[model samples]
Target: MKRIAILNCLKANDVCAGAACLKAFNSRSRHFEQYGAEPIELVAMGRCNGCEVGIDEGFQEKLDRIIEEGAEVCHLGVCTIKSETRQECKTITEAANYLETHGVQIVRGTH
Candidate 1:
């Protein structure tokens, strides 16, 4: 059981970032919990305004708030990043790289 934080870039393309990200992260978290893995804390880290592709001030704000609420691992699974949007996907990869650099193990949702 690992303490994980799944991060959603939540960049804007069309869909609402907050609700969409929460939905994906929650679904993934449910799967992890079902498998008896340490469930992931869904952390939506990005600008709701869809300004930047990378985790920036908005990202820090969200991350800080979520951390204050006790969130840890980082998973990028927002539709913008994980499914359709290109920049968002890049953010996801960067997030994975950052998390690993920060000493967290980066793995897939199936893990």
Candidate 2:
């Protein structure tokens, strides 16, 4: 199984139902559809350290740790990218940059 990790939005967690993200990943819909046969093993699911105010302490460290644990791919949950709020966009960008800098392949979108 290919190890993967999800980076979600902390703020969206309060309001979003997460059904779309869950369905897409579980059913291999949207971006997930490209995986032909390899089964995805979700190794970690973490939220953006905090809201737009600022990234939480040790956010980068935590993300790097996920990769160290064998997460070859990191995905941004829908809440991190598709949300209408600008704060969400910032968080997404930040998470993407961090993951990329740490050499983790990023796959945008979950469900």
Candidate 3:
């Protein structure tokens, strides 16, 4: 079975001003587990951490840790982008391809 992680780019509290992020995270968490993947590990960091800007050592460290342990995919909280600008569904789609090329699939929310 492949391990799956939830990708997020905000501090835990920032995930909620409303409820979209929480819903998306939980929904995907359950979905992946049902499909025989590891329960999603939320990869969140502080606002100062800039996880949204792209790769950083701290964030990369976490990703590396998961990947090293053989995480085969990441199911993003689709609503994450909704909560933020750069609704890069296009950038995200491209990123998914990139991640898959590196042998780690990046999936979107099912619900």
Candidate 4:
């Protein structure tokens, strides 16, 4: 199985219901339709802690859980990519970099 995950933006957590992402994957939209013949397993779905003074300490814990779950792909929600603030951008970049270093493929958008 190709383990996957969805990472959401904390700032837009209230606004984004995550329906689109789920719908896209559940329906096997183009974004995921060609993920080889192997079944894709959604192992994690979570949001960033928030772009504050710095990333939350628990952020590492969350990522650890995903990695432990054998997640090989992480689809970042559009909210994270379409963030309006620079802090959010930085947070996303940092998190993406971390995920990459840990061997997780980072898909820029989720639905």
Model 3 Cα lDDT, one tens digit per residue, 1-111: 345555543544454452454464456434444554344554431221343555556655655565666657666654446556746344345445655766877666533
The estimated TM-scores of all candidates read 0.48, 0.78, 0.53, 0.87
Clash total of candidate 4: 0
Q: How do these models rank on lDDT, best leading?
A: 4, 2, 3, 1
lDDT by residue (tens digit), candidate 4, 1-111: 889998898877777887898888877784776675668889999998987834677988888888888899998887886545524377878888888899999988766
* Whole-model lDDT values for every prediction: 0.49, 0.75, 0.51, 0.82
Q: Could you tell me how far off, in angstroms, the CA of residue 34 lies in candidate 4 after the best superposition?
A: 3.3
For model 4 the local lDDT of residue 12 reads 78
Candidate 3 — which residues are off by over 4 angstroms? 15-48, 51-53, 83-86, 89-98
lDDT tens per residue, model 1, 1-111: 345565533444456435544564456543344434344444434443243536677665665554554445554443434454345455556556655665655544422
Error of 2 at 60 (Å): 2.5
Candidate numbers sorted by TM-score from highest down = 4, 2, 3, 1
Cα lDDT, model 3, residue 62? 59
The list of candidate 1 runs beyond 4 A from truth reads 12-53, 61-72, 78-88
> Where does candidate 1 have its weakest 10-residue lDDT segment?
42-51
Candidate 4: worst-modelled 10 consecutive residues by lDDT: 81-90
**What RMSD does model 4 have?**
2.3
Off by over 4 Å in 4: 83-88
Best candidate (score: TM-score): 4
